[model samples]
Each structure stands twice: as C-alpha cells, then as structure tokens.
Target chain A: MYLFSAHNITKNYAAHTALKNVSIDVSAQTIFGLLGPNGAGKTSLIRIINQITAPDEGELYFNGEKLKPHHISLIGYLPEERGLYKKMKVGEQALYLAQLKGVPKAEALKKLKYWFEKFEILDWWNKKVEELSKGMQQKIQFIVTILHEPKLLIFDEPFSGFDPINVNLLKEEILNLRNNGATIIFSTHNMESVEELCDNIALINKAEKILDGKVHEIKNTYKANIFEIGYNKQEINFNEIVPQSYEILSDIHQNGISKIQIKIPADEMPNQLIKYLIPHMEMHSFNEILPSMNDIFIQKVNEQKQKSF
Target chain B: MIFLFKKLTNRSKNPFKSITMKKIRLIIQREYLSRVKKRSFIIMTILGPVLMASIWIVPFFLATMSDEKKVVSVVDETGVFVDKFESTAKILFVYETDLEKSRADLTKEKYSAVLYICKPTNSIPDHAMLYYSDKSPGIITQSYISNAMQTILKNNLLINAHNISKEDFDLINRTNIKLNTEDIRTGKKSYTEIKTALGIFSGILIYFFIFMYGAQVMRGVIEEKTSRIVEVIISSVKPFQLMMGKIVGIALVGLTQFALWILLTFFIITSLQIAKPDVFKSPKTEQAFDAGQKIPSADQIQLQKLQNQEIKEMLTGIFEIDYGLMILQFLFYFLAGYLLYASLFASIGAAVDSEADTQQFMLPITIPLLFAIIMSNFVINNPDGPVAFWLSIIPLTSPIIMMVRIPFGVPVEQVYLSMGLLILGFIATTWVAGRIYRTGILMYGKKVSYRELWKWLRY
Candidate 1:
C-alpha cells in the first residue's frame, strides 16, 4: 500500500508557480527518490507531503486517509536549509524536537539518550550546536529527524554537508529506517546514491514530474542495445568479426586481453549479441549495458526542456 | 534494528497531530527558556534597572553639588555701583578703585574676571565690559554682577526720583502670579504646573517602555530568521504559533525587566531616603532672600510664613494627583501599547531576511510612535481639548497621548473608548501580523517589497 501520496498537487508563489500537477506515490517500506535539477519543483512536492505548505489545487493522503493538519506529527522532514539553534545544547534541542513531534518528555529523553549513545555523541550532548563542526551538526539533525520514529520521513539533500564516512553511515541508517517499515522520500542530486538506495523514483523538472517508475524498470526502459565483452584472444580484430548490424563503440587492449564495447542496432536483442560474440571470440565475459540513472535523468530533463522551448 | 522494528509494528495507532496546543506550549517553552538563559538577556535584565535609576540619580547629584567660587574685581568708575555686588556661594565681589590696577590684577590671574564699570551714560547703564585673561567667567558669575547692578540702579532711581516706599518696591519685586484650577467633574482643585509635570512624566514613561520592548521583539524575530531555525520549528507548529510564542515570550521578558526596575528603583529611593534623609530634601529658597543683606524682623517672619504656605500648596498639589488611578492606567496603556506595536515588529522581522532590510519597514511602524511623542507635549497642555481627545482615542497614538491625559483626569467615557479601541486595534494588528508572518517566514532569499508584503497578507 502507498504510505503517502500527493496527487495533482499545485503550488504557486505570487507570479511564479512552484509546482504544477505534480503527483507521486511513496509505498510503504521503500525508499522513493525525488530526482530533479535545481528549481524543478522537487522541494515544493516534498513540502506538500510534509504539509509545510498546502497545494493550490489537489489533495494529499497519508495511510489512505485525507491529509489533515494533525497528520504533521506523523511526518518528519529535514529540509535542505535546516539547522539547529546555534546557542542551544544538543541533547536539550533534540529532546525538544522529539517532544514537539508528540512524544512525551520522559520517552523522548530515553530515545534521545539511546540514539546519542549509539552515535557515540553522548560525550557532546552538552555542547552547543555552534561549537560542533558542520558535519557533526548534520548528524545531530539526522538523529532528531528519526528519533520520533515518524511513519513518513522526508529528507532534502541530506548528504550535502556530510563527509564521505558519515555519508555512508547515513545511507546505512536510511536503509535501516526503510527496513523497519518507515516509508522514506529522499530528494537529492546524488544519482549514485539514488541508484544504490532507492527502490522507486520520480524525476521532476520545471514544476512537473517528467519521469517516474520502479528504478530497475525505468533503467531497462531507457537502455540502449549495447554489450561489453572481454576476451583473452587478443589476435582478432573486432571490426573484422562483427556483423554490419552491430557497431564497435570502442576497443582497448590491456594485459594480454582485448575488450571491446559494441552497440547493436535497434532490431537486435541482447541474446543475439551475446550469441554472435561467443562464436567469434573466446568470450570470458559478455554483458548488455543498461542506462545509468544519471544519464536517463539528464536525457529526460533535457528532453522536457526541448519540448517546452 | 529490532528496537526500531518492534516500535514500528506496535505503532498501529496515530498519536501525532498538527499545531496542537501541546506543541505550541512546547514551542513557547523552548523560545522562552533559550532566550531567558542567554547571557545577553541576563546582562540586559541586570543593566536595565541600573540605567533607569542613573537617569534620575545622576541629575540629582549634579544639582546638589556646588561649583567652586570665583572672585570678580569691580572697578566702578561711575562710583554708581560700589559695594553693591555682594558675595554668593558661587561668586564673590572685590571692589577696587583703580581700573588699570584691577585690569593688571585680572591679567595676572589674581581675579578670575574684572568687571570694568564704565561711567554711567544714563541713570541706568546698558552695557559693561568684563575683562579676563583668556576665557570669560562662567555665566552664573556674570549674571550675578549684571542682576545686582540692575537691581541697585532700579531701586535707587525709584526711591530717590519717585519717592517710592522701600516696602512697596520690595512687594512689587516679589509679585508672582499662579493659576489655580479645579476639575469641575471631580470637584478637586490642583496647581496646574504640578499636574502638567505628572502628565508629561507618565506619558514619556509609556512611550519609552513601548519603543524599547517592541524593538526587542523585532530583534528576536530577526535573530531566529537569520539563524534559519524558524523553518524547522515552523514545520511542527504553524508560523502563527511560532510568532505568538516569540511575542508572548518577549513580553514576559519585558514585564520581568519592568517589574525589576520598579522594585529596584523603589528600594534604591527608599534606602537613600533612610540612609541620608537630606539627600533628596528640597532646600529652602529663603537663602536667596537673605543673601547680600538683612531684613527687618517683622518682614523676615512674614517672608518665612509665606514660604511655608507655598511649600504647603506644592505638597497639596502633588497629593491631589490621582496616583492610584494613574498607575493602573499606566500599566494598562503600557501593555496594550506593547502588544499593538510588538506584533507589527514581529511581522517586520519575518518580512526581512536580515537586520539591514528592516529599515524600509521600520519607518511606517515608528512614525506613529514618533508623532505620538511629539503630540504628547501638546496633549499635556490641553488634556481636555479636541486634539488631545482624538489623539488619545486613536489606538496608534492613544497609548502615549491617553497616558498624558489621564494624569489630568480625563472624562470617564473617553478613557473607556480609548481602551476599547486599543484592544480592538491590538486584535486587528495581531491577525494581520500573523498572516504576514506565516508567509514571510517560509519565504527565503526573496527580497520582499511593500507590494510583496501586501500579497503575503492576501495569502
């Protein structure tokens, strides 16, 4: 079941329309990546789901019920431009945010203490936010976001300020949150992370959802008929053996092995390419190439821009 | 990981709601406590009372302390004013025969200044040259010599030429006119001068507190916005709630400071009175009458009795002021005024991204306050006039103009009308400010114009 969804959501700010008929479904226990370049209405849709803003014209649902003001406590949002009170102590601020999400003080304290200890930040609980480094502050904010165990979590550019090690740690926590049955909406420009973590994804550009589907299915749909083969028989030239229907994109000889990348014509299939390659050379490896999300994202946005112009 | 799963599976029921009273309370608590614990808040709280007390105490010290006495040598070539310039606490006179010798002495710094009395062109000379080394004598010393010469010339001419009695001349010189007023409605009489003073003092105090604390609220809002913590807090609570939480929290801070100032000032005044009874005691003006000469026993007794009567009237004038009602009205006006202006300040804080952008919006909010202060001077003189009535009834200026009128005992219905309008005004501005604050807080990196603010109001 879809844990949360914003259908036909439209939002405008004065003369500018921030989101127009943007819709997306976030299924339970899955990571939904909201992909877009800057100023593409991604933040607008995320804000609508979080109920930070109401859509100009559409509806939002949480757990199949019409979203209401009271449903905000069930939603946790870490905005792109997020911060803690610079002068506030970390533990105190964390507990305050937890209680603000409807957890009682005693429960919030217990949960915060556990998380702080787990993160190995118990020693810095009394430190003011301004005294911590930016990455450390991001960690504290991350803890605050998940401490309440919100049913729906939305993170906008969550990995921006994090170092590589901490970024990996956060990616682990996000996956962990999804495994625990919390539906997550992750919005970022980091396509690699999206490929690794997101089960379903949507791409928004110019205040419209341009593409969306299960990650693997969308990648397959955008794939070009291409195959990469590596063979130890370095004496054969790829151009002589390949058929006219296939084209060799590149060939490189290294370590007594010849590797060539070939793209077959649209009518060909991956198995035909593989069968043809195996007969011509002692194939150690043969694999068809599927488009990466980054390539598909750039192509789709560019396509939309061209269509509009 | 198991703990996360167990809680998730067990959480079939929803416990969270949007913008709950509980959440607002938490927001308020956070805003209040965080600021109250700040070093700046603590420092200002302690410093507020000291600054207020010094405003009153510093002038008192300066008034009571005497200046060093300066000697002025007089060369009366006219012989018309010899031995006339007597000594006072701040100035002494030394009569000399040779003008050149006095000039030489003045140059040598023996005398602070030399009064070169030219030969009298007429019965009363118009101008006199004062010679000194480099700098002129203080105004007080020069005024003393000028006044003594004027009096000697006028009295001598009146006695010799007009054959006027000395008693009549003295009586004429001492004549002073005072206006007596009685409130027809209350049937209470008072000296107008004292009532005017009470009115001005209370009006200035209200104006001062409102301007001070209202700006504090604005600065607090700017701090939250610039630090970018407002959005995180706003996601949980409505922007209206956040703005209110800040407004009310700072109101409490203002009240705390005001209460401390009142209590501390009272304590300081009381302790000063007890420790040194004469420190604030009003000095007798009889010393001025006794200076330069002596009077007959009969006249002296009569003068003393008259001075005693004047002091009594002054006391009665102060006692006749309705202090109980004035203080109550002061508190009411102060609070209403603060709420009315503070909401506007909060909205301005939200509209701008930083302190630099506040200038455009600040002028409109402050113009009424500035006009109110300037009009209060007029209001004090004509408390019952139409200008005072209108200014006091209008909510924008009422807080100050009304307080000025209250000490002079305004009509009861006018007071009710002003207060009713003030409350209605506060509610209206708060609603308006809440709207602006809601949209403005979420709007980041946008240079807001007046037109944009109006659009936000509609939103």
Candidate 2:
C-alpha cells in the first residue's frame, strides 16, 4: 500500500491553473523524483502534500486515512529558499525550531548536537546565524527539518549551492535516509542527479505531469530506434547496406573517422542492421543509444508545447 | 490515539498561549538584562536621580557655601540712597579709590562692579555711567550701594533742613503689619500633593514605555520579516505564538531595565548626599526673584499678581491629591494599558510584512498612545468630571487617564469599572491580534492597510 497518495490534485493561482488533475502515489521507503523545469507545478503539488496549502480539487490520503494537520509531523520539508533568524544563535535557534516541529527540548538538543558535530559545526553553536556562511546556515536548517526523523522527506533543490564534494555528501545522506525506511521526494531541474538518485520520476511541464514511471521504464518507453555508428573508413556509402527502413539524421567525418546517427523502424531494429552490415563494413563501434533523462525531458517538454498549441 | 490527538488538536488551545508566561519572561529578561547590563544605562539611570536630588538640595548648598562678597567702590557724588544698600546680602562697601585704579581693578574682576553716583539735577541723564564693563551687577550688591547713598542723604537732610534729632527721625519711620485668622472649616484631610504628582509621573512613565517598547516590538517583527527569517519560523510555529513570544520577551526586558534604573537612582542619590553633606543645609535668606530686575510698572504688577494667585491655586490643588489611591490606580492602569496597547503594537508588527510597511499603520496605533498622554493631562485638571469618567472607562485611555485622575480622588466604583473594562479589552484585543497575526505572518508582498486589516479581522 502506498504510504501517501495525492489523488487527482488540482490547484489554481488566481485564473492560472498550477496543477491539473495530477496524481502520484509514493510508496514507502523509496525515493520519488518530482522532476520538472522552472514554473512547473512540482512545488504546487509538494505544497499540497505538505498541506502548506489546500488543493482546490483533490484528496490527500496518509496510510489510507485522510490527512490532517497532524500529518505535518510525519513530513520533513526543506524548502529551496533559505530562512534563518539573523540575531538568533545557531544551536539555540535550531533547538527551538526543532521543538516546534514536535521534538521535546532534551531530545531535540541531543539530535541537534549529533547533527551539528557530524557536520563539524559544533563551534558555530554560539555564533549568531548571520555570522555563518550560506552553506553552514543551510546545514543548520537541514538538521532542524530532519531532527524528528520524519517518515516522508521532501527536498526541493536541496543541493543547488553545494560544491561537488558536498553535493556527493548530501547525495549519500539522501540515499541513507531512503535506506533507513524514509520515503523521499526529490525535486530539481538537475537531471543527472535525478538519474543517480531517483527511483521513480514524474515529469511536470506547464503545470501538468506529461510523463511518470520508473526511471528505467520511462527512458525505455521514450526510446526510438536510434544508433550511433563510428568507423575508421570515412568513404562508406550508407545506400549499399543500409535498409530503406532506416533514415540517417546526422553524419560527420574528420581525421580518418566517421560518425553517423541512424534511425530505423522498430521492425528493422539494431540487430537486423548489425546482421546486414558486419560483412559490408568494418565497424569500430555500433551502439543503440538509450535516451537519457535530459533528452527525455527536452523531448517531453517540446511534445507538451506542441500539443497545447 | 489520545496522545496523537492531543498533539494535533492542541489547536483548540492557543498555539501562542503555551509560550505565554515564558515569552513574557524571556522578553522582559532580554530587555532588562541587555539594557541594564550596558554601562550607559547604568550611568544614565544613576545620574537622573542624582540630578533630581541635587535640584532639591543644591540651592541650600549654594546659600550656605556662598560667603564671598562683592566689594563695590561707591563714588557717590550725590548723598541720596546710600543707606538703602544695607538690606542687601553678599555685598561689601569699600572706600573710594583712584579712578584709573578702580577701572583697572574692574577689568581684573577685583570688585563685582563699580558704582558711579551722579548728582540729580533738573536735567538728570537717563543713565549713570558704570565703570565696569558688565551690564548689570547682582541685585544684592546694587541694593547695598543704594542703601548707603540713602543713609547719607537722610543724614544730610536732617543736618541741613530741620536739624532734627537723628534718633527721633529713625524711630518715626519703622512699621510692621501682622494678621491672624481661623479657617472656616477644620479637620480637612488632604493627601500630600507630591504623592499625587508621583502617581501621575509614574503613569506618564508607563505611558511612554508602552509606546516606546511597543515600537521596539514592531521593529523587531520588521527586522525578522525583512531578513526573511520569519518565513522559516512561521512554518514551525503559529504566528500568534511567535508574536506573543516576542512581545512578552521585550516586555520582560523593559521591566528589568525599570527595576535596575530604580536601584541605580537610589544609589546615585545616596552617593551624592554622602559626598556633599552641605547640599542638605537649610537656607537662611534665599528668595525667589522676578524675571527682570527689581519690579515692573503698575500695570505689569497687576498682571503678575493674578499670575501668582493662579500659581498658588495650582500648588494647593496638588497638595490635595490622594497618594494611596493614586499609586494603586497607577499600577492597575499601567499594567492594563501596556498589555492592551502592546497587543496592538504586536498586531501592527505582524500585519505589515516589513518595516517600511509599518509607517502607514504607525499613526493609527501611535495616535491613541498620544491621546492617552493628552487625556492624562486633561483628567489631571478635572478628575471627577464626566469627561474623566468617560475616558477612564474606555480601556484604551483608562491606563493613562485613570492614573492622572486617581490622585484627584476617583471613586472606588469608577476604578473598578475602569479596571474591569481594561481587562475585557485586553481579552478582546488579544483575540483580534492573534487572528491578524496568524493571517499576516503568512502573508507577504501585499500592502496591508487599515481597510485590509479590517478585512483580515473579518476573515
């Protein structure tokens, strides 16, 4: 059973619809990527799930029960925008915010200390929030959000400012959270990270989910019979061995090597081409290219635009 | 299940209400500890009372210590009014010296002034030439020379004209007036007017703090909002709790400062007395003087007499104030008033998203605080009047206005009525403020105005 399900969610910002009949059931202990470009309704749906807002038309279910304010305690939300009290000290402020999230003082402090020390920010406990660098402040915020060990963790562009090393660090922690039986929702425009982290993907374009499925399945579903052929022989005549079922999209030849993109009908798949071409040509490499998440996003968004007009 | 529900539906209980006592404690602690801890606060608080004490004690100190006298070389060519100067204090008469030396001595400030006596002829010059560069001498010194001249003239008149006996003529001129009276009514119990003044003063102090500290709360809210920190806090805590926490925290700070200031004042006055015992000495012959020299002309004299009578009435009225009642009412009104308006200030802080948005709402909140000030003065004049009753019963004005009227002898019924209404107003205002706070803290990027606030209140 899904731990949380947002069924047919619809939200509007005045006259503009931000979410249109969007439904996604996030199962327990899995990382769900709510992937979208800027201005997509990913944030709107997340806000609906968090109950920071109410959907104009939808139902929210938590473990097969209706969601209420109490459900907030079950979710940990790290918003994209950074917010911290400038005059408040880091440790004291973190503890206070954590308590408000329902952890008692001693327990909150215990958890906060562990996170602070783990992040090597124990000395920052006494310093005012303004004294810390942006990354340090974000660490404090992250600790406060996760101190309760919430069941559902929603990260909205969590690693935007992080350098490569810290990015890997945060990525490891995110996976650790999922491993610890916490269902996660990762929202970002960074498709490479999504590919690395996301188990399932929901692509929102123009306030609509144009595509949603397992990451591998979605990549496979959007695939066309496209292959890249690289060869040392530059003067190959594609008309000799290539079937009429295939079309050459791009060709490049330089430095005694040739590279070409061939789109073939699924009936004449890559295996059929290989069968016909091995004797006719000496091939350095022949590979059917799987569509990447970036390519899928671009293709889906363009398809959505064309459909809307 | 019950525990889970308690965690969830604690909604019925005010989200802000849990932090009530602690927030107030923290706020007051912050205000008090921070302010009183500063060296400047300690110095100023201590200095103010010391200055006040010296104001009361310094004159006597001056009169006692002032033994040095001004020596005037009177070149009285005319023998008139030489003896008139005898009544003046702090002046000495010196024998005539060379004109060049006296003029030179005046430059050195050897004498306070040099008096040049001119003979009065049918053509008397409008002014007598004083060798000293100073425009005027002390009245006491001037009177001394005048008295000396008068005595010499009197002696001359008696010697030249009537050849009257000097002793007999002096006997005829002396006279004194005496009076005795009984009050028409006796046993009238009057409150010490100073005590009443103290109450009104405390009331005004409370009034000013409510405005000043209330704005501090507003500014605090604005700071958090401008820095964008409020958004993070709002997500975790209800806006009402946040506002109350801040208000209560700052109020604690204010109370702490007040207590520290009182202690410092006591210290300052004590040190002052110990350091300078002469300040407590009684004056032998010090007198209040007119704004100008001597006296004004006849018409001016009549106007001055009327003004003096008015002043005497005011002094007497102050003397009639009831100290015990005034103090009690002052405490009640101060707390009630501060609590009442502070909520408004807190609400104002919450409504406007940023500091820049505060000015538009500042006038509305500030005007009532000012009205309390104006009404405080008014009710001081007419304590039992209908206007006083009306204003005091209204919780907003009651704190300040009732405090002023208490010394003037407000009835027990009115005090109770005012207190009751003030508490009720607080309950209502807090409710309204909590609503506005919850709404406004979440709202950003919108210009909230009075009309809009009204809409929010309705919502």
* TM-score of decoy 1: 0.91
lDDT of 1 by residue, B283-304 (tens): 4443455454544355556666
Off by over 4 Å in 2: A7-23, A35-59, A70-73, A203-211, A253-258, A266-268, A284-309, B1-101, B115-196, B271-277, B282-328, B351-354, B443-459
List, residue by residue over A248-272, the lDDT tens digit for candidate 1: 8888888888788899988877787
lDDT of 2 at A15: 41
The global C-alpha lDDT for each of the candidates, from Candidate 1 onward, is 0.83, 0.72
Please tell me how candidate 2 rates in CAPRI terms: acceptable
DockQ (0 to 1) for model 2: 0.31
Q: Estimate each model's TM-score.
A: 0.91, 0.77
Instruction: State residue A28's C-alpha deviation in candidate 1, in Å.
Output: 1.8
Clash count, one per candidate: 1, 26
DockQ of the candidate models in sequence: 0.54, 0.31
